[model samples]
Target: MDTQADRLAGAATGCPYPFHRPAPLEQPKELADLRAEPVVKVLLPSGDQAWMVTRYADVRALLADPRISRNLNRPGAARISKTNKLFQDPRMDPDPPEHTRIRRLVMKALTATRVERMRPRVQQIADELVADLVRQGPPADLNETLAYPLPIRVVCELLGVPVQDQQRFRVWTSSFKSISGSSEQNRLALDNYMRELIETKRKSPADDLISAMIAARDEDDGRLSEYELHWWSRLLVLVGYETTAVQIGGAIAMMLAHPDQFALVQEDPDLMKSAVEEILRWKLVGSSVTMLRYVTEDVEVGGVTIPAGSSIIPAADSANQDESVFEHPEVFDVTRKDNIHLTFSAGTHFCAGAALGRVELEVVLATLLRELPNLRLTVPVERIRRDEKHLLESFLEIPVTW
Candidate 1:
């Protein structure tokens, strides 16, 4: 792999190639155009630094490299200043040390075994939700009824929120996250919301992740600060639903696109495993861009030299679509022999919610596949639309006639 620094100094000028990997719904034309350049470089609206890593190999190497820290809390790190509450919190703050600590605590409550235990409940939710849709007949908005609600339901249970309160949580949860939002307003609202939830949980605890974390923090003799716990709780609640929402909707859309593959999965329930993996790989949700990294030390990726502190963005979306890794990468093969996609990522910073996500998606898809045996898309593929601009890469509205 070549380091970005080894390439000509003036490579990615003025969004040269503008080679950012696009949403599953849209591919930026510059993706291929930027092949000649080391990586795409462009100044942000606020004069921040950014470089889009488009090649598969470079993206993987950069993401896995320790020198490239996930810790956005480092000094001179303006990349994360794009958001207020985001990098300010330990979650998106520093890499290692604090990042490791917060991740461990969250994972303690969210392990693969723990997540798997919730599958039956997830399937139960799926059944009831799908039944309502079946009664309603065709022309149902799958995104609203299915995609959005399913994750919300599961996460609500996981976090011990009363089911009826999910909608308020959703609005409160989304306010801070939106890119177009006023940072101070969203942050204050989020803090207020989290503080209220924490106070409520303190008065009356439940058998859920939030309670467990509070207990753990106490037993450790105050290893977790009030702020950390609050931030963790709010973060877990929102993140638990956000990515899963993207994957579930994306998976169903992928399945529907290929009728034979969709039918195959519907027939052989075992095939859902491969089907889900394929769906994650094929759909590159564009808007959820990982911030470009500041390479603390010089490094080589995809045969390019990256200088220290350069804004190096790993193209997870691009790596998932790489041809060498998956046979017929673009063909949407449900039974792909080698499905080692970087969807969950790898190493210490791997997504904490992945196991839970897999379980939720698998259960919901299984229930939907079996129940709506004749389920099909009501809208044309073109009209189906993909949310390239927003974070979720959502379907604006998935119109399904099941």
Candidate 2:
């Protein structure tokens, strides 16, 4: 296709930074608009009219619709510029054929078995972080101490990157995550870091991701180029922690606030799986952006017509809250059945790190409850500050005390 439709160009009135916050967790303004009209055509800043499908059923159908393309490389693509900060990803820019290749390469390392095997290590990391928290006492910053660091540490291990350089790694990630930095500068900083790291890993074999990538590159040609390997490692590190950084805090916040649910998870560790799913659902993430989709053709959707060349947002957060598909969608019940929440998304583009994320959340959050049996927020629930302005919505500082 010569043209790429940008969703950012469409006509719609929603939160500009939907990834951060919107009309509270249980209530999204779009839900009501959707009920009134399953597909609402709205104008975007770029002057394009796009369809915003709100119903759970409709959203899922649209996501699975083969006509809904994810390629962002089209001529008119609605680029989520790094400055946008609306998404932790801009790599969503590639159209299929090209996109499929990068995605397949990513699938190699972010495999289900690798994530599953790392559970024990993740569990240990969680314990170690919390142990330090205990030493520091209540009124602790979970965001700085746990939410952010845990994922960084895990990804570092997965990439075979050294943890001894924790300060540098933290600074690297912080720059990318910074709301104030220029996108080019952050990208440059990240590129430089990855290049240096890759060179180091190449010269001397290590036990982390870079070393593994080098081995994998040698084994498979055209799969990972030197530049691709560099970017891949950087992308892994960046995407690896973006959502998870929020989830780590969001998971604990969801459970702690819902004592009954938290108690159940604490009592039966097996329930950790369900608890994590529920957390993924209830997370107050994604108010403005979603897994962006481009229409490959004109498709009739839920009594509405979506024309070809249109860009769309697969609002997983809204999809997760659809009451028709989910009974009591607003309730924070961990026992919800047959939950196939699309938080990690569905279809061919399903999150490569879905399994890894699940293991990390389950092991870490479960351990927190078990070790700090009396854990409670040091600050008022309502008073807790969330980075509602960024793509990853999370507590800026979840102060906790036991």
Candidate 3:
């Protein structure tokens, strides 16, 4: 097991540290090379060494492993970046029983039936936004026109947040994503804002998610603590706003870039579901690693023994590109069958908003294609600017003409 040649080979390949953690729109080539290896030691931006697991089977196993933990409070847990460490939310970073309880309560408020009920509103929002984009004329930034506003409005309405407060919230969220800002300061400000909103909801409860959670806390024998309530709301707003926005932008970019696939979907409206799934699979908009999970005990993956307390990052991007699991993995096939991409992740922490995000994507894509059949990128694909400091693989401006 102590083969010098193996270690030498790994060292020779050059550890692809950092891998442009904040702004890699395309999957890095080094990740593809690492997928061939059992586990590759990578140096993170925080200067911590972690074992990067890239293969689909191994990544799925890593996410589901009971010994692996998502708890950032644990000593020596691997951190993705200093910003992540500073902006950690208990609702997102906690390991189960706590995670289970919070997730269960949140799920009650975001049930599949509840999310489906919002489809008409989602359609209306999409229609209105498209109408505005049309009124504004061509060479408009879709990121501002449709991508950002759609999810922001949906989440704001769902949480009873005033639509007027969106600009302030955007500033707060942007700081959380920025590499230069004081993450703690931004987090504290956002936290205080959420707490105040919670108080407002408590005084005059409405029919929104925040009101429902407040009722659950006040009437359910303290099932949710004050701290838990605040963090849960923050988590919901962050996920609902950021991830969906990035995804909407990424999906539109991909569809526009791939004219053939775009034509296929436009020709056959029935392929909408498959098309959305393919966009999630093809786009590497999310982080290469879902979130760092620390190894609790010495574990063997691909014949490599990773010691306890070591950081393990499951490469969702690579898993989506795994040749073993997907045919013509590089091709963006809207009609690809047997799609089981791990973009929303898997296991205990699988994204709770998956259904809602799917609905937004489907509605936006369908509406855009139907309403603006001539929609095309205003700039070359290479000219589209990326937010180099933003955590998500996001576009600064997705200018489009219809």
Index of the highest-lDDT prediction:
3
Q: What is the model-wide C-alpha lDDT for candidate 1?
A: 0.67
Candidate order (lDDT):
3, 2, 1
Q: How many residue pairs clash in model 1?
A: 15
Task: Please give, for residues 1-402, the per-residue lDDT of candidate 2 as tens digits.
Answer: 211122332243533323223422344554444444465554433344345665777777776777887765565655444344434345444445666676676676566777777888988888999899888887777888888889988888898766786546656665564444336765777778778888888899865656766766324335666766776787678777766887787777767778888888777888878878888876455443446667888887677677778777666766777777889887888887788888777767777778888888887787788788998876556676766445454457777878
Question: For candidate 3, lDDT tens digit of each residue in 1-402?
Answer: 743323522554435454653322466666566666767777666656678777899999988888888776667765666555444554454777767777777777777997898899999999999998888888888989999989988888888898788767766776665544446767788999999999999899988888887766423435667787888788788889887998999889889988888899999999999999988986547566446788889989989898998888887877898999999887889999989999888999898889999999999999999999989988777777777566675688888898
TM-scores for all predictions: 0.87, 0.86, 0.92
lDDT of 1 by residue, 101-206 (tens): 7666767667677688898888898988999888887888888888888888898888888767777766666545444433575567767877887778878998
**Model 1 misplaced stretches (Cα beyond 4 Å):** 1-29, 32-38, 42-47, 73-85, 88-92, 182-187, 217-222
Residue-pair clashes per prediction, in order, are 15, 18, 0
Q: Which runs of model 3 end up more than 4 angstroms from their true locations?
A: 1-14, 18-25, 86-93, 180-185, 217-222
CA lDDT scores, all candidates in order: 0.67, 0.68, 0.79
